[model samples]
Target: MQPIILENVIKNYLLDKIQVPALKGIDLKIDAGEFTVIAGPSGSGKTTILNLIGCVDTASAGKVVVGGKETGTLSEKQLTDLRLHTIGFIFQSFNLIPVLNVIDNVEFPLLLQNTLSPKERRERVLKFVDRVGLTQYAHHRPSELSGGQRQRVAIARALVTRPQIVLADEPTANLDSVTGQNIIDLMKEINQTEKTTFLFSTHDHSIMNQARRVIRLHDGKIQANA
Candidate 1:
């Protein structure tokens, strides 16, 4: 099954008793193991699309099918379960718990699942942490790390569950050019080696250049998908 599919999806938000349309009939599909980007400026509905696919929001019209299931038909509990088990998210903010160290932060997601034993959880967390090249800073807190390093922690945390799909929202917007490229390369390597499907939303042309496929959006509509 495709990791993400949107068929004539529309999203509208109420603002001051008026409907503000965010997405205008967006039709897209992201195949499994594909490295793709949704590129657009602000207000072009990048985050809206991600939210729909991530099951954080429902579509106002049409369908949003994720991992072979239509999101509109899923119960709240089912959506929660799908997100926890099938999808990983890496935000631009690096949403790490300030109080948690590297190991604790990465282990946070696994704690939600009962399928893994404590020892197994630690092993998975350590495996992802080491995969992101943070083995030396496994004990460091978010405050002690650099922007790039903190993002690495976020990557490890997102991947610890071994999700089929990873959604990154402007992940490199907060880093320097060099550091941003490094982060992109790391994600690309993971996408290739682990065969993880990656869908990124960014306005960074540098990132667009790195994507195997780029879907450009403007004014809440698709401009290109190539």
Candidate 2:
């Protein structure tokens, strides 16, 4: 099954009691293990599409299927479970808990799911933490880490769950060019090695160049898929 599918999807936001269209008739599919980027200028619906596929938001019209399950059909609890179990999100802001140390942050998701023993969770968390090159900083809090290091912790946290699809929204936006490129390379390495399907929403040309496939969006519609 494909990792993501959006069929004639549309999303609207209520602004000042008026409906503002975010996505317009979006029909897209991302296969298993594909590293793809949705490139667009600001307000082009890139985030909207990502949210739909990530199950953070639903379509106002049409269907969104993630990891073979139609999001529209799932209950709120099921949707939460799907997001927790099937999707990983990397935000540009590096949404790590400032008070939590690196290892604790990475282990948070496992704790939430409560499916693994403490020993198993620690082992899994450490594996991903090392994969992201942050094992040395495992005991450090977010404030103690550099921008790039904090982002690395975020990446490890996202992967510790071993989700089928990882969604990154402008993941490199806040880093310097060199750090951003390094982060992209690190994610690419993980994508290749772990065969994790990655879908990124970014306007960064560097990320677009690194992506295996680029889907360009404009004015809330797909302009090109190449």
Candidate 3:
């Protein structure tokens, strides 16, 4: 089944009453459990596609369905709930809370969901943290860890809810080459074992190669699908 469906999607940004188009007439579908990479240079609408699929941005003129749910009409609060429960996000910058420890940061989404009690929250968070190989750093704040370690914590946080899809935007932009490769490997492993769909927006060819399917965007349109 299709995990993501975008039909005639269009996105525009308004700057001082001038409408600037970002994504124009996009139609795409991503299957479940596929490692899909949306690759392009800056301003190529790569991130826009990820945002649309992740339900952070609504299209100006089209339809977007995630996990078979039509998102064109969902209110902002409803979209937030959809994202919190069904979608996970990783970004170029590791967006962990500075005030919270590793485990606490991982548990934040669950708190938003209000599903698990404190003990269950702690248990689930630690399980993901350990899976991402950060069990020893659970008590440390974001300031206490290396860049790679922080990214691992972000991975754990993103996956803590057992989300159906993970939307990653330039996830390796801040890391060194080796560290970036390791991060991709870890995500790939999770995608393989957990059957989670990973959709990434990146300019990096290394990431594109790692993906099972690659969609290349240029000039606000998809130019290639491999």
Candidate 4:
């Protein structure tokens, strides 16, 4: 089934009273459980696509439907609810709380959900922490972990929510080559085992090659979809 659909989508930003087009008449569909990459150079609209799919930004025209709901038609509260329950995000910077340890950071999303008891939350967090191979460093703060380990923690945090789609923007940009590949391997493994859809925006050639499907963007338009 298609979990994400963008039809003739357009996005524009105002810069110094000038309207800059980021995405122009783009059409795309992403099937569920696919490991996909949006590959492009800087200013190629990769992040803009991710932001639109993640429901964090609006399109100037056309439709963005996630998990069977049209994002533009939803109210603010409905949009927040959709984002909380259906989407997960990973960033290049490893956006983890410095004060919270690995496990706590993983459990943070569940706290916002408030659907699980403390004990249940702990169990879920521990499971993902182990899945991400961070069980040993569960008590360590983000500052104490290596760059790769910290990104692993971020992965666990993103997966702990059991989101249907995980949108990652330049997830490995900060890591060395070996570490970046390892991180990609981990994400690929999780995508296979958990059957979660992963859509990543990256300029990294290595990552683009690793993806099962690659969508190349250029100057706010799709140059290749393969």
The top-ranked prediction according to lDDT is 4
**How many residue pairs collide in each prediction?**
0, 0, 0, 0
- lDDT against the true structure, per candidate, is 0.94, 0.93, 0.91, 0.94
Q: Residue 125: error of model 3 in Å?
A: 1.2
Estimate the overall C-alpha local distance difference test score of candidate 4: 0.94
Query: What range of 10 consecutive residues in model 3 has the weakest lDDT sum?
Result: 201-210
Model 2 clashes, total count: 0
Decide which is better by lDDT, 1 or 2.
1
TM-score of each: 0.98, 0.98, 0.97, 0.98
RMSD in angstroms between candidate 4 and the native structure over all alpha carbons: 0.8
User: Which whole-number lDDT from 0 to 100 does residue 138 have in model 3?
Assistant: 88
lDDT (Cα, tens digit) per residue for candidate 1, span 154-199: 9988888989899999999999999989999999999999999999
The TM-score measured for candidate 3 stands at 0.97
Per-residue CA lDDT of candidate 4, range 1-226, in tens?
6999999999999999999999999999999999999998899999999999999899999999999999999988898889889999899999999999999999998999999999989999999999989889999999999999999999998899899999999999999999999999999999999999999988889789989999999999999999
TM-score of 2: 0.98
lDDT of 2 by residue, 1-226 (tens): 8989889999999999999999989999899899999999999999889888889899999999998899999999999999999999899999999999999999999998899999999999999999999888889999999999999998998888999999999999999999999899998999999899999988789779989999999999999999
Query: Model 3, range 1-226, lDDT digits (tens) per residue?
Result: 7878999999999989999899989999988888889998899999889989999888999899998788988899889889998899997899999999998999999999998989988889989999989999889999999999999999988999998899999899999999999999999999999999999887788678888999999989989988
